[model samples]
Target: MDRRQFLELSGAAGGTLLLGSSAAAEATPAVATTNHPKPVGAVTYYTEIRVPPPEKAAVLAKMDELIALMQGKAGYLSLSFKQTIGESTMGRAYPNPKKAILAEALATLDGTLSSPKVPYFYVMFLRFDNYDNLLASGVQAWFKANIVPSLFAYNAATTPPTKTSIALDFHEGVYTTVAAADRVNGYMTAEEISTYLASKQSDEVAGQYVSVNNHYMIMDVNREAHYNLLRENLNGNTRSIFRPIPGDAGYDDSDPDYVANGQPAAADNTFFRKAVTREILQNAFPEGEKRNYLMHGVWETIMDHENSHLDPRFSAGASQVGSYFIAHPVEPFYITLKQDRFIKSA
Candidate 1:
């Protein structure tokens, strides 16, 4: 199915509406690409859901039921349900609230540190073997049938439930795993990753030990060149500053530059993936066509990620690409609460 058809099946909207605003919702979508490379990587449905405290249990129960239905589907790979643990404290060292509005939002809805007055946010990743399977997963159908009512139905007597979806927002997009790597594994293909998963026991396969960190930034559609350049250069900078030498347990602590460059004292084992082809609800600050880019990384511990921000090289790279950011970059850590994988034996 084409992009429009896919959207029709899934109620994925391009702009977020204020809680009760009736103003026309406008989305400045990135111009479609012409003669782009054929998509040839694992695709995922990345969804974000905001749930009120009272509805959390109900939402999770529905999620469990949904997982059961997905297990037997064709080309189904894995499903991960993640809970937001905290935001990046290290990021605070840099200038923030690039926009005044963001500062106000954070001040009122600061869910990262203490009690949150706003709804809790959760992230779900539904992976498939390829783009076709992702488009045909039928998850949207299941959600429409089973999950939609729970969000909107409060009073049984009312014809349309007399209430709106309890969840504050649902933001989602189709994303492709464009790049992935680890120091020991080096780089893995989709088949190789399947083999790797097959070798792991259930606990490791579920990713019980590591923390998943999501780094989000906004990129102007017209500045594709700048985005490409940042990706290329940032990859090199992160690898040099963070990744340990292959086969080595950790970085040489004796090197004076190690601590200075923000390398943690402990062994650094991090897996990184460059996920592309996803967009988030747009805002006015971008001032042009824009897309959201997620830099996903798995770290041994949250501190391993937090300490990396001390590196001056990272700051320099950020300044170089600062203009592309329409909003302040947000990095948050998540814990896997529920996960399941279907791996063919190697």
Candidate 2:
């Protein structure tokens, strides 16, 4: 099923299931402890799931069931699930030419949306007040029993005998919120971002068109220094907001002249709506033991995101931190499917 259908189903299935209270524990913007590598605050279990297009609906149904099961749990704070839009723009060109060529080609095809060769991607976020509470929830156990088997179940009904199961692939990690910002509360406290997001779902669902820019990177600098740099330098709207010229004939994203310096022309783009930064505390996937960070931004539109990359101010600020990157960042865009908070907004 498409995102809309899946969302409608999710709404009907779990809308009233909001459970848990803010008193259990609130994830505040983290403060790094000297002895522990992970920040101190709320913990999040983040997962990326890849499934064949035909199996998307079944998996999502399982997700809704899981959400229902987690309701009223002792420490549960919030849950959000989103689907990729099948569009990815590189923050910088890929180092591997083959991968870059392949990625570029796939973006133009429905393969990213669904295909045996390329599966659809989905992201899930489950937040809790603390590690102990998260462990008590038994969400992992529930997922293993209820959802894991379906991924590996063979479609014996298909024509080819050798074609067995099209099992889904997944990567999971435990993370902490480090820094965040939004238009509603400027430089937000951790609680503020959480509260803002509780109401964010309605706006996204209404528009049916929100752009989430995901920046995945491996950092070489001190984690705290990096986090502070991002919070202080990139948190504001400087050069992020679009300004129009007189008689510019309005914004046209499709115009051939709409690009400047490999990004959307300055005059045609607008600012992002909200942004946050997070760091994996455990179970780093793909690459292990390397410090990994995620910078997430919710944009008004895709063009708003593209335009920000070339802003001279952005370029200058980014250059200071560029050498700290061990690998080129992989940036992709996604749309929210379901977002529900059980905790009271702060």
Candidate 3:
């Protein structure tokens, strides 16, 4: 759909409305292309859902049900659900309150306020085998029949057992993965950062993991020349690189073997078809300082629908590096990007 149509569908007027029969008639979208020499095949559906504070639990339950229904579906790979943590400091991270789904839902419930936070609460990432299946009519039909009813059901009766008004905000888009990188520990050191930038000039790396603070850096020289321009400045920045423990193995002071080989698995380097959406959450420290003491595992799932069509040389594993710094006190916000890649299976 075009930008205008997408805005309306995600707006207050259309937020709570079901996809209905019309969605089943939507023509499948064309596969997106990238500047890369080879074509990629995976597709993703990234959705953002907003619910009132009181309805958070209920909405999540409904969402879980929807996810369960999607299990074992043709071309379906994996689905992840993440919630935004901490209060929003910026004024309306989702602006245009009049056009927001949550705002309109609240107004309908008679629970509207002058300045509601409009919880940009949940983010769902659904991966599929290809763009065609991602937009298939069967999928749309299933949502209309099962998912929509549970989410938008509102009760008008209130005599003995009053039913609360159902309010929700939803926005979604299809995306193809283009490029990704992962760092084992936290952020890269000042020296490592310099090496990374310099290597990109002579390498074909689609993307590179900088630090937990910077996360994955998309390597587009024309679009992101700042990486090269600010190389000198990056060298002086002293943010500690935060690395979580690898697995269930607890940290030990005297275990020499544990100290020698306790790092997590290295991530695979992969590229995608297009860059759909880039979400950067700076600080979602839900666990506070204690979170730092726990081990954190970071991995990427890179898949291509038409894996046979691509060259095998591009599927090589990633290189390793040593830990650079200690974990920062403030939990680092995650950087999530929606992109597509070609893989052998879902």
Best by lDDT: 2
lDDT of 2 by residue, 1-346 (tens): 2323222322223221111111113212222345445434566776665555545677788878777776767767778777765333436543322121222222343532223444556677787766667667887666556645544323434543122444443445566655454442443466654443333323454455444434334433355566666666555432233323223345345543332112233333332222222222322222222455556565555555555554456667767656565544545566777766556434
If candidate 3 were superposed on the true structure by all CA atoms, what would the RMSD be?
Answer: 17.1
Over 179-295, each residue of candidate 1 has an lDDT whose tens digit, in order, gives: 343433322355644333222213422444334433334545544566455555445544455533334455555765543342442323332122111111221123234444555
Best by TM-score: 2
Of the two candidates 2 and 3, the one with more favorable TM-score, higher being better, is 2
In angstroms, what RMSD does candidate 1 have relative to the true structure? Answer: 9.5
Q: Which stretches of candidate 2 lie over 4 Å from their true place?
A: 1-39, 93-115, 152-168, 187-190, 193-202, 219-221, 237-240, 245-289, 342-346
Q: TM-score of the candidate numbered 2?
A: 0.66
Give Cα-based local distance difference scores for all models.
0.47, 0.48, 0.30
Every model's TM-score = 0.61, 0.66, 0.37
lDDT measured at residue 174 in model 2 versus the true structure, 0 to 100:
61
- Ordered list by TM-score, greatest first: 2, 1, 3
Worst lDDT run of 10 residues, candidate 2, spans 15-24
Candidate 1 vs candidate 2: which has greater lDDT? Answer: 2
List, residue by residue over 1-346, the lDDT tens digit for candidate 3.
2323322432324322111112223322223345222223554565444544334555566656756655546665555554433211111223322111221122233323322334334445566655566665255555445433333323323233222445343444454433222222212343332222222111111342111212111223222232232322222111111111233234443644334322222222122121111112111111111111111112111111111012132111111100211221111122232212222243
